[model samples]
Target: MDYLSIANGRVLYILASIVIIVVIIQSVLFLRMSWKRGISIGISKTKLKETVKTSAFFAIVPSIPIVIALIAISPVLGLPFSWMRLSVIGSQSYEMIAAKIGASSMGIANLTDPGYTAQVFSNSMWVMSVGIIWGLVLSIFALKKYQNRMKIVQKKDSKWAEIMVNALFFGMLSVFFGEPIVSGGLSLLVLLSSAAIMLFITWIAKITGKQWIRDFALSVSMIAGMAFAILFSNLGAV
Candidate 1:
């Protein structure tokens, strides 16, 4: 069996289309629910509408990397599976790592090996899907309780709650960036350039008093950082 033929088959495309439809339905339902809840809480319609617009903007903007990743990995994983995986989870690094590990386990040497088989493709798909199941399970079961606990903390001591939330945010950043930072060289340089781009955007937003532009800071910085990495790689600057 051809590896890519299986990965990008019509059956897989159909399945991916179904997932996309389900996601759209879910997004609409959640948006309606949130809008109603906001109205109930006396949030002005204008503010809520603005919030929706800003949210949509943010969603599309930050997805640049996911689109790039989908293209980048399509050669190894095929377009349909990569599209579906990124659309659902949006974890580019995790999916790539899972797929590579799966391929490695099959003794393929690497994802780009010419001798890849349908079995290797199947194994990679299974690994990518099953490895992320725990996060979904926790989201379904623990989210409500976690939300309630945070509310209680905030109600009791807002200052302490703020500190707790910031701590969580920074802790996540450290974990996410720790490995790449320690790897040094190109990864470290890209990270610094991205941070610099974000800081520059924040300064522009502050000095210009156009705070809305700050929302795109992450998107711009991420794309620019990727561009920088590509430039450095091509120029043999590492």
Candidate 2:
């Protein structure tokens, strides 16, 4: 079989293609924004850059599991229909067309034929392409809204709101992109932990006249720092 027929080869190629395309687009936008701002260190710039990079990265990251799933359903070249004759064509041979159609239909519901693999792959790729585009547009809109919001708030609770929204957005990305570290239990833990930590520090800063702002700043700093660290670490590992 050709390299594209191999599990790792085909899967990696699909994911890498998606990642490269998304990253290039995202990077160009990011560079344009950064250029316009002169690398401003305000809340929005930091948050936007971080969010775009992480979201784009994780978006492609989900493809790994997807590819593995595709490979699992494929025949083993010599063991055809024994395991799932209903889904296979012949003994020790793959029902290539059916498998393709099944995969392209996004979970094998509409694939009634028995020999159309290319159709499945093509359809699925088109679907994924659309999803990627939608995600990128949403990311851009979200960043714009966030930056606009940052320019208006100046009161004590403003920073808190910014932090909260950042957390929520990050959580959304985590949920949407299938970040493994943000599993159910871990998500709850991160939420409770960041909330508790932020509240405690903010309250202490409120009561004390000296460096309360500093303490609050430190708290927010730690949260952002830790999150950035965790995300980049995961990116490197992935």
Candidate 3:
């Protein structure tokens, strides 16, 4: 069968649904265990319930963007694969970039480009999987050692270590925020607008003592940023 047909195939959807079901089962088990443990540790039932409520609320808010991203990618990669990838280890940005690289390597410009076949789709999936597999494997094997090394460095010079950690965070932030600015289009506007919304949300949360606002601040800012992007696109301002 051709790539487009495979993308929307029933078998793929069934497999993806099975993976999701497994994940759901695991999550339910973990939650049950954690709840029992919390009770054993003398946590009150009310407090435990509240904790679950807050977690569900916060998780739902952040997951909106992820769902949006999944929808955005579904057309190109097919619903089942895109859903599975995002639900598992793949971040939206990373998946998009990996798919582009995979397509380019196969002489296709992008995921949506013509002449893409089932083989091409398989190649793209392999590329995406292989690209991310190393980090997961390394973390499973070496993360504790890496963390221990950081702890040793911190013990040797706590102040210097703090500075180093902060620098690393800022450097990562710069890369994420700087790329859109360098691209100089709707992306730059979206970045700036999101930053502004986040700052405003933080300020209002602090002043108003609205804990819920603080909890949902990131989600609100991201939604606002997306709205601004749409408006700008409609206005041809970007």
Best by TM-score: 1
Residues 1-238 of candidate 1 have per-residue lDDT tens digits of 6788878899999999999889989989998998999999999997787676666766775687889999999988888888988998649788888988898989988888986889889898888888978977999999999999989999999999999889999999898698778888788888899899999999999999884677666667787898999987888878
Instruction: Return the TM-score for each candidate structure.
Output: 0.76, 0.33, 0.67
Task: Estimate, for each residue in 1-238, the C-alpha lDDT of model 2 and write its tens digit.
Answer: 3322533354544655565566668778987877567556555655566555555554453445444544554442212211222221122223444344446566545443343344454554445344335555776679788666666653547778779789889988677436435554444445555556676676776788545353344446445545755775576632
List the lowest-lDDT window of 10 residues for candidate 1: 211-220
**lDDT-better candidate, 1 vs 3:** 3
Stretches of candidate 1 off by over 4 Å are 173-238
Model 2 misplacement above 4 A: 1-107, 110-116, 154-156, 162-238
The better candidate by TM-score, 1 or 2, is 1
Which ranges of candidate 3 are over 4 A from the true structure? Answer: 24-69, 103-114, 154-163, 179-210, 221-238
Clashes of each: 0, 7, 0
TM-score ranking, high to low: 1, 3, 2
Query: Which pairs clash in model 2?
Result: 78-92, 80-92, 97-115, 97-116, 97-117, 100-117, 100-120
lDDT of 2 at 83: 24
Which residue pairs overlap in candidate 1's backbone? none
